[model samples]
Target: METVDVIVIGAGVSGLAAARLIARGGRRVVVIEARDRVGGRVHTDRSGGHITDRGASWIHGIHESPVAAAARAFGMPMVEFTVGGYQPDSRPLTYFDARGRRLEADAVRQYAADIRTLNAALAKIIAGAGAEATYGDAVERALAEQDWDAERKERVREYNDRRAQEQYGVGMGELGAHGLDDDTVNGDEVVFPRGYDELATNLAAGLDVRLEHLASQVDRSSEGVTVVTDRGVFRARQVVITVPVGVLQAGDLLIEPPLPETHRRALGLLRMNAFEKVVLRFAERFWDAGVYGIRQLGDEGEWWHSWYDLGRLHDEPALLTFAAGPAAVATRTWADEDIVASTMAQLRRLYGDTVPDPTSAIVTRWQDDPFSRGSYAFMLPGSVGADHDDLAEPVDGVLHLAGEATWGDDPATVPGALLSGHRAAQNVLGIDIPVSELWA
Candidate 1:
């Protein structure tokens, strides 16, 4: 059996980050990944001269994001989009209703006000009724208190639902009322015109990474830890399990003697959400090229609610549709032909009847993937602040866990995963590294 100072599971950003830091500290490390390639959920696929990100795409905080720093270090070109901006030539986001009517200034203002009212009501509910309240319940209470008519109420509700789905990857009912209030690194978001997976590729450089090695079990002892994989077994003094929350929840990798009660409970308190993307390549640019994204309230729930103009990023006549929460789950049951047809119908509703069929299309089914059962993690309604900390705690100083799920403030982001890995490395090395330096 091969042995090392540390054995890292999953070669995603988190595992790669941990291995890199530990190896830089003069400790031998090896990363075992189930996938044939690196970058678990940061896959970038190219087909017919078009590049599409099947997994994670954006650097949510370019200035402070470790992924962005890695991209810069790797010399990857990035493009920035002004979110929610409405300049005539540089419009980033445009909202439309079921009839394809663009949301005017007055309606947009009303929606913002309604959202503010809803958030304030939710905060009050959390303060009075505690953290057990669901975001859906809070929104309902707030909407009930408003004196709007049925049409306005329905419109606001739909907008709220879309926002919640996009942010949480689940409906408001399943999301905690206080979940959206968590702090995260703040900066302008950017995208890699080439691919986001380049960041992971650069991070994994010079590291001992074993692909197609699926970890089946982890046996921990007072002295060290043993990791059993489909290929073989490896032992190490320390193990960093950086798999996604969905993989852990699915019990894909068994832990000998099981995890501690608190850890198990904490895992249960966190929920992995479903989010998927579908990319379509058309013969010509049928949609407006100036806009970065199009948000539509569709009558049929089959098509995606948001469409990203890939042309703006790479000058390709492609559009990527994003579906989250229930819509994403529902898409899992659709066949490619059916999904393509439905998407075309939805596009026709927005771009008129002359819309052309896509020459090529690609769909991402993260929910159905065995390695990643869902997109990412979110807190349940009853979860406390310490839940993520408890999840991150090392077991016997031999078994350490790190991933986006273990990151409390910025869960479900690439930078969050990287930060969690750095924190895990710090725990194993017994060293102090500034939080900012991890990204730098």
Candidate 2:
């Protein structure tokens, strides 16, 4: 067994950040990852002369986000999309109705305002919600009491549920009424047109990384923590477990002597979420550049409810769409050809028969990934943000936890993961990392 100052498990952004900062602080750190690649959930593929991210692509928030800090630190190009997350500015949304007729710009603005009003109303329901309240129940109850017409009511319901599924990566019914236990970092969002994984690559430079070393168990004794991996055993004074919450929730990696009841209960209260993305590359652009996002209102069920103009992002003439929660899980077993054709059907509903077939396509089914099992973690009915801290609470000063799931604010975002890593590094080593290095 080899000994080091610290052993960082998983080479995702979180693990890399911890190891990099620790190593920078003059400590010996080693990172062991299961996959051959280092980015983990930020997987990017540069296939067919196009940079398509199979996993997370957006920085989620730009203001005060560690991802943005890193982008500035590394001098990476971060382009702001038109409709940026939940705080989209005054951008034109080229939306259509279920009947395939494009909605008027004023109608679109009114629809946007309606959703905002609905969310505000829902927030009040959540505030007074009982202990057993679920987001689905809260949403339905709010909708039921609304004075809006049937069409307007249906549009809000579908948009809220499906979009919530994408955001939290779980069915609304399974999520806590308090939501994902996330505090939105106030700002616009950005995406890396070059590739999302470059940040990982930049952090990995000059670090000791061992890829394809799947960690199976973590054992702690009198003096130190020992990590058992298929490649070899690594011993360290402290071990940072940066694996996904889904991995821990499923007991995929065993921690010897079992975690404390608090940690176990916290783990049990949190649920893994699945979010999958697909990119369709066409020979020519059929969508409008002025329109930031395109979606169908009043068309419910597991269909393509939303799509973004990917062509504008990188000038690749592609469209990006997603399926989350139940839809993502159900689509895991779907054939690629079937999935492609179904998405094309939705496009035809908007673009008519002249809608050409995709020249190339990229799809991701994160539910099929054994490492993550799902995308991230969402709050169950009784779970709260504090549970994340409980799970992150170090075990006997020998084990440390860092990941998006462990972070309360901005959870499930890349910046959240990176900040968690920096916190772990600072906690384990008691070193001072300039705040300027983080957000300035």
Candidate 3:
């Protein structure tokens, strides 16, 4: 049996980050990954001349993001992610009715304003009602207000419903009750110039990562922890689990002596959010003028929220599309051909005859992948307080859990994931290392 000072499971960004930190401490560490490649959701496909990220395309924030800090340290460039305004040819769009006719822009803007007001009002109600009332309940009550008109009010209700559905995989009723409406993600996000996966690869570079080794069970009852894989068994003083929240909820990975009920309950309460990316390589750039961003059809349940050009990316001129919220459900379950077909159909609707079939397309099914069941973790309704606390705590001083999902308070970004790894390493090593020192 191969033995090490520390064993990190799931060689995603978080796992790799933890392994790097622990190994740098002069502790013998081994990272076991289920997938053939490293970087879980931070996958970069270089099959063609251009490089595209199939998983995480954005760095989110440059100043605060630890992943961004690491990238800059490695001499990688960071680019500002802008959708429109620079390109005169670029036309921003508003959601249209079921008919082909575009909805009134003024009405749409007013509708959005109304929704923000309603969310504020609803927030007050939720605060007073404690955690009992669901976000849907608040929304419903807010819609009944006397300030808005009946027709416009109806539109507002429909818009809110669709937005809620589009934002969360579950319905509006699930929001605040069983889902996350209170969960706030900052709108200002950044992207990596090279690729997000480069950060992961750079972090894992020089570290010992055992690829294609999936940990089936973890036994931490003895003095050391035993990680069981199909190929062999490895022992270590401590184990760090950085798999997705969905994988933990699947209850497939066995833990001997079993985790405490608190941690188990946290796994149930905290859920993984579906955020997928589709990379397309076209023969020619139809929207060739500027940083073109195209919003896919079925914006109601759209899998493709928006696509942008790779001009800032000097390597390849491809389009990277992101799918999140309710739109991600179909994409999560979509087959290879189905994904391409649906995307092409969406492109046809948007660009008419201009959009051509992609020369090659790469679809990443993180949800379906056994190693990582979903993109990343998000707290559901009723998941705050102790649930989030338990999710981050180490078990028996032997088995430790850390990942994007376990990052409480901090936004679930790549930087947070990397920080979570460093935190987990500190827990295993029985040291309280500051975040700044870890990076330094």
Candidate number with greatest TM-score:
2
lDDT of model 3 at position 333: 64
Off by over 4 Å in 2: 82-90, 180-185, 435-440
**Clash count in backbone of candidate 1:** 0
Per-residue lDDT of candidate 1, residues 1-440 (tens digit) = 99999999999988988888888888999999999999998899977677888888877657656677767767899888644111121344676766788878676666667666665666676655456887777677778887888777776677666666777688878887766655332566677889888878888889999999999999988999999998999999999999987888889999986889989999988888887777888889887657787777545533466777887678668888766788778777989877778778878888899998899999788888999888888778887656887888989989999988888867778877888999998998999766444434
Whose lDDT is higher: candidate 1's or candidate 2's? 2
Task: Give per-residue CA lDDT, model 2, range 1-440, as digits (tens).
Answer: 99999999999989998888888888899999999999999988987788988888887668777678778888888887745353322456677887788888788777778778888788788888887889888888888777899888877777777767868877778889876446454566678888889889988988999999999999986588999999889999999999998898778899987888988888887777878888889989888777767777665335686788886668668888887787677788898877788888888888788999999888787888999888888888977677777777878888889998888766777877897898898888776786345423
| Each prediction's number of clashing residue pairs | 0, 0, 3
- Candidate 1 wrong stretches, greater than 4 Å: 82-92, 127-129, 183-185, 298-303, 435-440
What are the clashing pairs of model 1? none
Scored against the true structure, residue 310 in model 2 reaches a CA lDDT of 80
List, residue by residue over 1-440, the lDDT tens digit for candidate 3. Answer: 99999999989878988888788788999999888999987887776556677776665435465665677677767677633211111244434443334446675566557767776777666665546656677677877764777766665565554445434444466555424433443443467666778777777788899999978899897598999998899999999998887777786677787888978888777666665666777777775355345432233324544566766566455776655556567566667677777767766665576677888877777667776676666555665534554777888788898887777655355666777888898887777766544445
Ranking by lDDT: 2, 1, 3
C-alpha TM-score for every candidate = 0.93, 0.95, 0.84
Write the number of the candidate with greater TM-score, choosing between 2 and 3: 2
TM-score of 1: 0.93
